[model samples]
Target: MKKIINEMKVRLPSHSENEAVARTVVSAFSALIDPTVEELSDLRCAVSEAVTNCIVHAYRDLPEGEFGYIYISLRLYDNREITVEISDNGCGIEDIKRAREPFFTTSESDERCGMGFLVMESFTDRVSVKSKVGKGTSVLLRKIFSPHTSEEE
Candidate 1:
């Protein structure tokens, strides 16, 4: 059986500022579960990558100054499992497998290192990516809390 403790959905323009917005929302939502500082940091970093990818890669087709929207959903389970889903309606990844490979970035001119997926995977217990060319991409992240850091006994 699955019990949901809390859930929230946030939508924002795919801009740099909103990246912080997503991270803040996730951090605040996570605070309720008393995650360790490391866990919190990892969560924030993963969120940053996901949001950045939406902003940088997803809306590449849009004319300059025109931006798309990013949807972020967060769910907290009774068992202290946190799930974050970030989606973009911008250009989708044509090669999900190659994209997930470390250092595989399309934005070389922007100095992108292409480690977004790798970082997300490292921080979260599980990460899933779904994308369709010209449709969009959705990233789902899951992390289970274990009391081990300073924030927890």
Candidate 2:
């Protein structure tokens, strides 16, 4: 089993501004392992998409004056593998398979491209989502860097 080098978890309100908080925390955690510029960029984008999904879809059903919480965790292993887990205690997806299809969105507005999961999958090596209609949703993302990456600057 690989030992964990470092790990962090944060819980924030399901608000749009917290999306930046997720990116900042994940990027800072990744910096310790010396990821390449491209890798870091991908990590940031993936995290942003995941967090945005939680903000937009998870707690969407809350009453006008209330909001749920979003939980994000970052774990780094000795083998240079990173795992990111984002979960929300809000209205969950009714269909997992259908939700993952590219361009599939339930929002009525056209502004939503319905590519959040696709974007997350493109940047991460693995993506998994679990949810129940009323329990909430959880997204897990994993990516391993090449063995030859340079040390942190």
Leading candidate by lDDT: 1
Off by more than 4 A, model 2: 149-153
| TM-scores for every candidate against the unseen true structure | 0.95, 0.94
**Model 2's lDDT to the true fold?**
0.89
Listed per candidate, the RMSD to the true structure in angstroms reads 1.8, 1.8
How many residue pairs collide in each prediction? 0, 0
* Predictions in order: lDDT: 0.93, 0.89
Candidate 1 Cα RMSD (Å) = 1.8
Worst 10 residues of 1 by lDDT: 144-153
Report the lDDT tens digits of candidate 1 across residue range 1-153.
769999999999988999889999999999998888889999999999999999989998899999999999999998889999999998999999999999999996697999999999999999999999999999999999885345435
Instruction: Please give, for residues 1-153, the per-residue lDDT of candidate 2 as tens digits.
Output: 999999998999988998998898998899888888889899899999988988788888788878889999889999999999999987899988889999999887537988988999999999999898889999999999767534545
| Residue pairs with backbone overlap in model 2 | none
Index of the highest-TM-score prediction: 1
